[model samples]
Target: MTDHGHNHKHASHKTLTKADAEKALNLVLDSVISAIKSHHNINITGFGSFEIHHRKAREGRNPKTGAKMKIDAYNQPTFRAGRKMKEACN
Candidate 1:
């Protein structure tokens, strides 16, 4: 396959079709997202961990009007690399 900025290669013996690949990706993402919604952490060995981070409500400003506003509290999804993943990058 031609490089498209990503250098990673699949090590699997079987080839994956575009539709199959997308479906698999969506399944994995949906599972992780659901875990986040339940305030659970999704950890993948040698890859990374995903979790929901809580953010407190805060004051913010509008760029156009320079008016003060309140930013509502929210939960955000975040990821942290595992030790092996970090080491591989270096």
Candidate 2:
């Protein structure tokens, strides 16, 4: 493990082929994406919580035409780190 920059730690774990690692990553991310899409909140114990936040619609002006537009409200997922996970960075 070595420090690249901005306190980003890089560690060499079990050596795996690129294809194998990509497949595993995609599988894990897919599960997370699916869970976030369907559930309101997901708590990963020592990691953190991924919860959806609702954003209300607002009127905004277009840069090109300066025309007022109505924006549609939507839900966005946000992550909040837990104590154990937050301590790991330090």
Candidate 3:
């Protein structure tokens, strides 16, 4: 998952009550996760987009023992902010 460096407390200032806010947030998150799981791209205009990224199997290193290892290919979820979202942050 992408780490934007924000925490739950930071989002708790919304007008809705904590429970309602959490429920709404969870619903949205569940929908996004479901879409990604189905290999579908989700786009929320003016907010962002979510899609899957594929990585081929490759060699990797084990940091603890400095040993080489084979990393299996995988599909990773990725997000990209929309134009309006970027402008809002700046």
How badly does each model clash, as a count of residue pairs? 0, 0, 0
| lDDT by residue (tens digit), candidate 3, 1-90 | 222222244346656665665666678899999999999999999999999999999999999999999999999999999999999999
For all predicted structures, in order, the TM-scores are: 0.72, 0.64, 0.75
Each prediction's whole-model lDDT (CA) = 0.79, 0.74, 0.83
Over 1-90, each residue of candidate 2 has an lDDT whose tens digit, in order, gives 322321222123446555555566667668788988996577889889898999999998999999999989999899999989999988
**What RMSD does each model have against the real structure?**
4.0, 5.1, 4.3
Which numbered prediction scores highest in TM-score against the true structure?
3
Residue 55 alpha-carbon offset, candidate 2, angstroms: 1.2
Candidate 1 CA-lDDT value: 0.79
Tell me the deviation in Å of residue 85 in model 2: 2.3
Candidate with better lDDT, 2 vs 3: 3
Q: Is candidate 1 or candidate 3 better by lDDT?
A: 3
Q: Give residue 81's lDDT in candidate 2 (0 to 100).
A: 96
